[model samples]
Target: MAQSMSSPPPALAARGSQGIILKETSGSRLESTISGSECRVMEFSSDGCQLAWCDGKSVTVMDVPSGAVKYTISKPKTRCIQFSPLGSYLALWEPYAVTKDVPAGTPNLHVYNSSGELVTEYIQKKQQGWCPQWTEDEQVCARNVTNEVHCFSGGAPGLTCDNKLQIAGLTTYALSRGKLPYKIVVYVPGSKGAPCFVRMFAYPNLNASAIMASRSFYKSDTVSFSWNKKGSAVLVTTTTEVDKTGASYYGEQGLHYVSARGESNMVQLSKKGPIYDVDWNPNSEEFCVVYGFMPAKATIFNCKCDPVYDFGTGHRNMAKYNPHGNILCLAGFGNLRGNIDLWDRESLKPIKKLEASDSTQFEWCPDGVHFVTATTAPRLRVGNGYKVWHFCGTLVQCEDTPPKQELWEVKWRPFPAGTFPTPSTSSTAPPTTIEQPVQQEKKAAYRPPALRGKPYTYKLHEEEPPQRVGAAEEKEKDKLSKSAQKNKKKRESKLKSKEQEQVVITRGSKRGAEKDDALALAAQILRGNKDKVVDPVGSGKSDSEKKLKNLRKKLTQIEQLKQQQAEGKQLETNQIEKIKTEQSILEEIEKLTLS
Candidate 1:
């Protein structure tokens, strides 16, 4: 309705039924609270703590961190209160009933500096709209009417209204961080007069809008939409109704889709009856959904609809992934037989399942190394005021405590670096020698598998190690070589000795033949049976005894020569095979290695 020039932000002042109200500081249980209702919403200002709040008919500012009043501005009944992007001024809105048939507009937005003075009343031109919400990042704020929606930027002049575009029943809009072309998906109606329209806006600040897709329903036929992890896709919930009776016919469905892929590809998710609420894993890629209603679980799923955990039925009251996306925590919903499971992404195995029975909200320490959840509710504190409980049996909470007036939306606040699940100390490298064939099987077969010929290969011939030689060792080796040479020579000599032994035997046998011939002569000379050489033993010595003794002596001579030759031969055949092997190996080395 009006516009004013810029001025310095006013010092917050406490007033009647109003007090310093500091909100949005995150924690399980808020460490801060409003000094009283009529003070300014409590904030840490450059000078001191400033608080501000609405008195239904006006807005007041105060410094409750110190007892000082800053300013006050009278306005139409205000519903919600917020500071500017730079926290320069105050903007107040007229309250709306969520179910009220009319939309949210003409809701005077007054920007006031620290002096309780009005700077502007930029009344949005669109008529009949629902929830009007600002992006948490302050980049955009959206307003929706029956089938029309418009989003505006503070930098743009005048109240820009867009009516050509459509959303279903204006269930509301979703805001997120990072770059955009924000997927400002709005729920508008389809051809059948039901609210199932989800449109993605290009510049959230303009009337230039394009229809992304529309969901269909006949009666009570509006749908609500939520963003997926990356804001690239949205999950739209719709109800189909009977045209004749104005009664909802078909049940509810949650269709998931990505804008890049187009909504036609939206996969139909299992209906958890009619979902009252649904939230996806913030780390997006790691998929998990939290739905309202008991016995309904935080079902983990891959991008495909297949569920990850076969332990299918467990409700994660609320869950979050550690910044690194390694560990995940599911809390709050479990029966008598369930565990609070912690998983390692590498192993995909539950490292720990705390049997923490009492379900309360939890927050990660700035370092993702430690996360805290409430097992049992706190008794000494305002048990009703907060849903905080002791962590893993310890009473310690966290660093940033919440303010009582603020509905605490606690995140680990991702320090971005340390807030991920701590990786265990580890190292991975191919070993020095992967000799274990079994292990080789498990490793990814690299470099195209070995030509599978035989289960056992001809033992891969490897080169032998070099022979070591120091002076003393070389001398010993030389001595050994000489000994081997000598033994070989002895073998040759022994071969000659064998020949000589045979000759001796041959000569001895010839002598026997001669003696037999001589015996025949003597027998003939004596003209009777007689011994050879009978005349030589003229005394009492018998010719037969003499012949026997001579025979023994000749046999002994031959026996002694044979024994010597056998012993000599044993010395010569000294492990000839071992020596031959060494020689062959050396020859091969000379051929291959030297060349």
Candidate 2:
């Protein structure tokens, strides 16, 4: 085993013969391929020095650099595997089972060390929240037990539970990473009229008196937690079994932020629909959330929960920040059309737009400049494959499974922080070595022959147009002061009065009312009221009829204003202006009838 193994390459696992292929991250070259019964589960050590996989017969751990089998444990039924941050320990989980000989069932979760020695085990019945958590130093290990959390101190080899945090209805717990004096956050679902709560506690203390932050809310049956990279705070996504409003079939969800320093806030989303995703920036000072109904909106908010930038509404339901936190990938998949949009967080400009149809998994490379998207099996039994992409939207590598074979999963090997520096933002995308088949454009839906060229006033939904990234901030900058606004209105009023007075002076001209009406029409155009004077069809007799109809509508509005004025109501500026146009409206009606 050599120190060079500290940066392992990515691994791919597919069914049938292709057990596991370790591919170099620098290019589309195969580093090594380990074939077995079937590579069902594969994981890389946090340091990337070792690679482990289970093929139904046994679990194998290999030193990445030497290509030597460092440890082999016979765990035939293992379903998942994970390695500690420092690669000091490995954890394996098997499907929970019961037998006549052992009715209660055996401990299905096993923890082992680098020497292939069993260190600990637990009976994790449910597979949902199965993996154990470890601090960055691997000094503290935490696992969820029945209505409690068991904490193991003194890292691997001689790990032992030295403390326990007890909480009734404890369903899930998350361990924060980074330096020691680690923190733990726990979730408790509500029952018996109590509200669901998520609370944080500093490590070792593990008591009520040491609780740092807590949040309580209603309508939550389960929750998922996401801690920022620095481990300063955590975002809890609360979800219910059903949405009471019946607005979404996916259920109702809310996002809440809880920091380590006793500060908490329920993140307020602008839209009123299901929350699709929330990802914290690597800097940990800001986060991005994708929420609302179909054609969802994505917004970035600061620590105070104030929106910093809105990505606007789109057919996207997921937002992911790259390893460097400089790039963001907002994508729409599953039920919506598959469109992937890459954006530069610093510039707030879109980097690239591409599509990976039927993609179910996405992962960023340790280098932060490249990513991988895959369409795996079970989620989609057909078209199981994966593609490697540059952040600038280039398809660097594409691997489609053979017709008989099905790809299950593809993973980028985990590397220690600072192992690979973030590529410069100005760098261009690498030349595409793999070509993706160009898909045909979807045709517009069929319309009846009679309505092919006819104008229609129907729309399926109000599709919001694309907006500039800083449009809101730009508008804020363009806002006028109160005094300036008042002066502007005064100037507009004087100009309108001057034009009206000029029309009155011309009322005595040779054309009389006809010339006066033409001036009034010109005034309407200057005031942005051309729609009121112009016939949309630009036709013959119908144009005159439309003008007469508009004039009668204006007279009716004038009568309503007079009634309001008689009732001692103060007319608004625009309302008073409309009243003054009444005489012009009557003159226009007479001219239209004569014409």
Candidate 3:
């Protein structure tokens, strides 16, 4: 029932009609038992330090570790007891007989501090199925009855019923958690064929005038709502019938996004039919919805209700978002092999799928990296326990509930803060220095020539003489000639052996002696050795040489044409000069004759 991070094993306080027993889970042993009147209900505080129990007429608060009674209060008829989330106060409900002396509207619930001091009492008409609810921070307590919601706040004198809000048709409610300002979401059914409304009320003072109702949707009888992690927005899933059938009918469902300030937006989640569920991401940036009927599909959506991603999950039964992380776990009953898929919000994809057959419950550890999944099992069977798992689906531990005990609930304790070592802050003290061992530089090992990355250079063992350039060329030519002769002899021998030898057509032997010879002759020609053109048999003259000869002839022709053009230009210049002189002389004669 309750576990503490400070302790090695979890402490579970089990209560039955006989007595109350506090058992340690690490070892199958009872630590302590408070045996008296039949205990009706027992609950451990959020901090796991205190345990409270109520029998029909009296309430007892006991220290969990020492089994010591801390406080006890007795009433005429106590119905139930609930400890505040912060362990500061306890709320006990008692039903008083509605007689003539007692008015019709009688305050039956009482609030008391840890020291058993009476805090407050309210005149709420006790309902058959109504129970008091508290905000996550324990700053406000709310009691819902019919269409009215009563809220109380802790004050100087006692718990005061500060605000009471009345909606037309109240169905369900959810309280915001975390650091955001506390808000209460209440669902009000539509009146006279109108749409249902989701309303938000500020905590401590939920006045009727301050009700902020969200945009309404078509007539939906079943509505489920969940608050985002930071309480900035609330996600509402509504199922509305499409056809007016008396007995059985199909319906449509939609997911509505409403901000803390009552602004609303919605998207049709299932065109096929009503959506099964919707869960919000821990960061309040996105949420996921399970839609479709058979072979249901799961879709993740942003705050705007826009679809981010979707996957097919066969008949999804439940989907939950981790409170401390962005991982979403979806489980369905249709799959016998794989039933759970862990989706990562950052990646927008599933990171793991687990094959947990018939898993009905999932609880994430406070660390967020690990979770626990449990499956229902038949009595006296072995499959009833839970398995601790990392987010990757690896099993960390498996635990079985005590046989025949019928596990009511199992939860991982919230890890305590300040458990990690704090940094040292003694600045006045001398700083301690640790001397590290001096490491000697290691020389690299020698690598063989074959293993070295660079080409290995070897010293010549002996030197004969300084070679001339032509001498090296001559040696290469001699080697080529000898290799050619050897190839020719082999070809002749093959021909002689074969009586009728086919015409041998070779594209230069593999040794490539002909190619070497052509290269050598070209080298000589480029060096202006006109007499050394050694053309190999069966090969024509080198094309390179022919191209060189044609280039030279064209060059000569170009020079000759340039000389002829220059001579022609000189002749033309002389003729033009003579003509100009004659024209001037004729003009001088004409002028003299005219004068």
Candidate 4:
């Protein structure tokens, strides 16, 4: 259900080095604040009803609506927490530790109900891939075990392990979101010259015979999967450790598509480079990929793997579709200068350009009209803060970490689907009482004292500025049919060629127009064949030589076209017309040779 009057307003939570703050997103009003200990991590329940966080001592779950503490579980050393889809249970992961008393490391992964009672526990050693995967309905949960996946059916308390997917050398698995009959995809890396493979299996029947779709690839050392919102299909991105072709240093990557109905195929990327990011549209029928080298390209593809629209090329490494799938945020962060471009999905036109240099994370608010970009600790240890901006590129709120303190994380509280309606887009930013920060003017690059006065060229590697391709050219692009567009291009090319020829004709000591006239006259005389050649007394020898040279060049081009035609080469309309003029050109050349 959408947000009711009694429901909590959408909130923004930030965890700094020493404290955590939860504030209402609408007015930036502080709702809750917990301090005095290092805030480790924070998570909102899948339904956004409860907010949970760990502070090195205990895991606290807060009822978001009432701003009251719901549960305070005494699970110290917790590194991560995740709430199941329906928010009925929360899973926590603590680093595994070996002690003299319990050397095997008592279950570090624990699941607890809303009442703070431990429901289940498992021994998950490594922090990576340690979280228990849950289906959207929360009726099933699974986790990776030694070379296999153990799945449990029913709710948290007294959950029964009724299914186990035993794949030799299983590395990882992903559970799809949404209604019943959920699908799961598992990956197993290649070994001994064997190809790596992924297999999709529906819930309840994960056996080999129950596999619905499968894909195998050779160049992958590891792979990641992106399932559309509907969970009917998935995009698999495979990566290799090294590029054997030596074309790139970042390694080779490939994208493949697999659906729930036994459809599997490789997604052919047009450019050659690492696949930076792939995101499926909320509609689940289309997806976008940002890929290729240096000036990477972003393109939207339909479910059939056909390119729907190209966002041209820019310095982008990430593509994010808002919850409504109407706006897409393309950004380049880490190594590249942080530049964000927002595009309208319908018109395929850019709507805004934003920059948050040094940002390490970006996410859209469930409302879809607001977004948050943050620069936290460890990634850069500097510029640790978060900025909330209206999707129109207005900086609505900017909070920087205090000196000596660092921001650990920032997240918008999640809400159920349709809880926040999509706001109509407007170029004008809504008025906010919070004062926006004044962006600092860019400083000039430093030059050496010795070369200060010397004329040296310095080039700054800057991201390509946004160019409004659709808006500027959409009229001509949409008004013309495909063939009309092609003919238009041809006409433009011919006009350009004519202008270039005119430039050459007007250049040099001899006027090219006169030579053209001589050629025309020679062709006319050749057509008559009996017309006597009139070499005027003052007819410049240079002019005749230039005309003869032009006629001979035309004859040579015609001969080449005729030879190509004889060789069974298909000639264009203009090429065939040029071939028809071969005899006339030969007659003209004969007249010039005889003269």
Candidate 5:
């Protein structure tokens, strides 16, 4: 079927034995007809404005809606016609060899511009080979019997077929449809008949350096190979045949995964049934495979080759991933009824199913959300065309071709539109810098001598030291020197007095009498009677006993002063001086008593 953009209502052209029927896509009404017989192939331009068809030896290019022939090329033995992706050119080729009487090296392939002018012709080295194919990027390619692919650069006036590369034992090949441009995957039989391998080759050059070969397997005859939308992996289905004695078995089947770099996990389908079809999801990393015959099953597998979903118990005929790759369409003939099941790839569940007595082929729209199912008429009857439907099972429209005509094929015209969202660009913010205050070394704060033994406490606000002027600095230095000298003197005098008091206490007996004598000296110093104080002894007189009592009272007062100093309390300078004087007097009294 050919869909034309030039047609205001989105026209679809279906070929039948009578001719070609042009109908509106939104309705079943016919718009125009191009009368022809045995139309073998039809294709629409990239823009969907022009339609082209080949009837064996002749090809016709037409304005789809007007049903008027733009140009007719009478090329004998023309097998197929294809429009370039850019809609600027068409490729026509003959798959079979030329007749013996034809000129010695006649060209079997011809290239024509949109204006129907001959652009180039490809002369074959051999009499027969595959037809020429156009790559997604518009390069013309053909493979010869020698397993060598020849690429021709499409340009004005002609195509250059000078570039050629050999792929030994090439069985089949598929071009990647993903971001990796022009990556060609070719299957080649293994050396020594061990197994077959799938290898990827770079386009154009087809260099040995870029070739990645997959693992070898016994089933070298590949049924089909499909590439994921991301071009990360390829799904391959192969069949193996075994001969025992005089009997031949052909049931060994397998499904394998090959990475873009040609790595294989060597996973095989569990069932012994032959794999009929395999399709990769365009939007995800999963694929669906159809196998078995009696009660066929469609199984979906992730990239890891793990089964994720199963459509149980049906005679599966065909399964395909929608262009968006989010939906899987499964169709098969069962119980005399054709079943078309639409499945959501993400959910792994069925979204819709339509049953028709003769439905067979399922073709998805380029929009991805819609698809069409082609059904044949029952025994040369009418009503044999295609049913247009949304993924949700809603019938959009249906058009039946002329009666008693077989619908050869149905396909949506390829358009330059995307069903998936474009990747968003990352908007990263620039790094930021923070300013910090300049750090300065701080001097240890000054602490009073009385509080030096305790833990240092931090001050919320410390007063800055006064800055000294030129003359005032000298005066300040002198004052500090004098104060330091005075403090040293006081410290020395206090140490000496403590030593003398310790000596007096050591000389006396370890008794209350020594304590009393020191107390008496301290009291005399405190009362300003430094010379009257005397050391008490066992004189056996009442006056001596009274002196002892006075010494005890003064000793208690001296102990209280020491306690105050230990508590971090400051003692008056006079009191400190008085204590030092008492210590001196006590030492002298001890000597006099001893003598």
Candidate 6:
């Protein structure tokens, strides 16, 4: 049961029944046409210029300058297909029912990416009626349902704990959206009536395996998270949820100052009303936010320690911190006068205010380059046809030329500033050198091809060098060479010393021989022609001479002594034998008897 209608979509009804309002931009007008599906809202894009509308049957793509219809997309009728923020891809939010039998049950959510070519379908239940957002970096997609926001990481696969969020929020169901190019994610653990107060995780895909994470928490629900280029200052909106009787519980939605380093310095934006969102000035000095619903208001906090711009009160009023944070754009929404207001960063006074025909979602380019507004359909005077709406945001032709696009801040940088630098004269200056400065050496991110760095091991207990076979050769060589020259010299000195001893001994022998001969002559003189038997005077030489003579005459003397001793003994024996013969003859008779 689908109903087709010839009724043109309501000028303001961009989202059918759902009331989806597309944010404004400054680019060329989007292609628009009536579609066949009965009463549906959708936006279409071709070659980038988006033509969006609500409750329309079909969308037509056309050439920009010539207005030529390029292509048309027809389908089972989807909610919307939007050009991704970067313009390289398209994001389609397709909602289909589980079955006609049940209406309140979970519905299947499908996403068609990269120009309707690839689609990934996922079912998100438990917390129903959710609208998800694609993060600017395409790293994650988020959905907002009831009081909590569900975000799914794009790189993750399978059902993991981190893959889902049951973010508890007890505040008013209003969510103010803000994004910083470098910012990731924040988590606040809410307990009961208190606005979610827990750790806010802030890393890009924590290794998918959940090995590590960079997270911090705030004890509140904030609508806006603004970033300073240095990541030092982020403006956070504080909200205080109040009950029906106006009894305030959850959150003191105060403006907070946080260093990108994750230091929380809270600044209460308003003590009573819920400060929807907070944004920092491009210069990082101040921040402003929109609050007070019936009478939308804006307020600014100047310096970290001070209050600068305080635009105390107004309704349907909005404040935008530009991409660069240099300028703050203020626009008022609601009755009386349809006007857009701008404010200077230094002067709190209004510099310029343009009567905006319609809608209030706009911003300065990321470069602080241009002003983009939502341009409503052209003014018409035929038959109460004032119902024309501004499509997607309009591209405000910049009054003051913006910074070059080349200087645009990209979301991520592959190489560090230390590794590469943009062409700047200051960069060429030689870096200062410090003596004995402690430097942390960086390890190689990737392992070397050849090295595995296995466990330390001993090479099978090598034999001691002292007992090795090769040691023998070295030992022999060492022995031969050990102090060779010095030892040879010592040997020569020792041989000389021994020669001196031998010389002394030989000389002593010669002297003894001479003394012995002299002693013999002395004996001859001492005897002197003895007729009266003077005998050889001391036939033995003087004691000293005898000692010398015997020492010299050793072997010959010994032989002569033995011969003399034998001759004397033989003579005595002959005498005894003769005497014994006489006795024996007489004794012969006696001997015979004794026998």
Which candidate achieves the best lDDT against the true structure? 4
Candidate 6, residues 278-376, lDDT tens digits: the string is 565645666666665434556665555344445645443566754444446666533323455555454444544455443333434322323444322
lDDT of 5 by residue, 1-595 (tens): 4333222224566665666666666666555445666677788887676788876657888876475788889875676677766777887776535577975657767888888899777665433334454555555444443586666655232444656667667756666655435666777776765667767766665876767655566745444666776667777676655522322256466777788665677554645465777777766577777776545667777777776565665656678876656677788752335667776655556676666456656676665556677765334244577777656655667666755566656656455555233211121212213222233445767778998879867755342321211345567567777878688789999999999999888676566666766766766665465666666545343653565454446555666777788899999997677556556545653454444
Clashing pairs in 2: none
Worst 10 residues of 3 by lDDT: 422-431
Using Cα atoms with residue i matched to residue i, what is each candidate's TM-score against the true structure?
0.46, 0.76, 0.56, 0.73, 0.60, 0.43
Give residue 320's lDDT in candidate 2 (0 to 100).
Answer: 90
Candidate 4 TM-score versus the reference: 0.73
> lDDT per residue, candidate 4, 1-595, as tens digits?
5543222336788888768888765555666468755778889987777988888788889888888899898987888998888888888999888899988879888988879989888787888888888888878888788877878787563345778899998998998976678888999999999988999999888888999999988999888888888899999999888999998787899999999988898887877888999999999999999999878988788888877677777888999999989999999988887899988887777788888889998988887778899998788787788888888877777787888888878888887787766655544676767766556788966788987878857544434443432455777788889999999899999999999998876684365556655755664454464454544224356766667667756766776788899999999999999888877877776767577
Error of 1 at 162 (Å): 8.8
Q: What TM-score does prediction 2 earn? A: 0.76
Off by over 4 Å in 4: 1-9, 26-28, 157-160, 433-595
Candidate 3's clash total is 3
* lDDT (C-alpha, whole model) for all candidates: 0.44, 0.80, 0.61, 0.81, 0.63, 0.41
C-alpha positional error of residue 219 in candidate 2 after TM-score superposition, expressed in Å: 0.5
Predicted model with the maximum TM-score: 2
Cα lDDT of model 1 by residue, 107-180, tens digit:
35555655666655645343233235445444565555444655566522125653234534554555443246
Ranked by TM-score from best down, the candidates are 2, 4, 5, 3, 1, 6
All candidates: CA RMSD in angstroms? 30.7, 13.8, 28.1, 12.7, 31.4, 36.8
In order, how many clashes per candidate?
39, 0, 3, 0, 2, 42
Question: How does model 4 fare in lDDT?
Answer: 0.81
lDDT of 3 by residue, 479-584 (tens): 7777786887899988786734332333335246566566545544543546645444434446654454344334344444456667784445654554345434
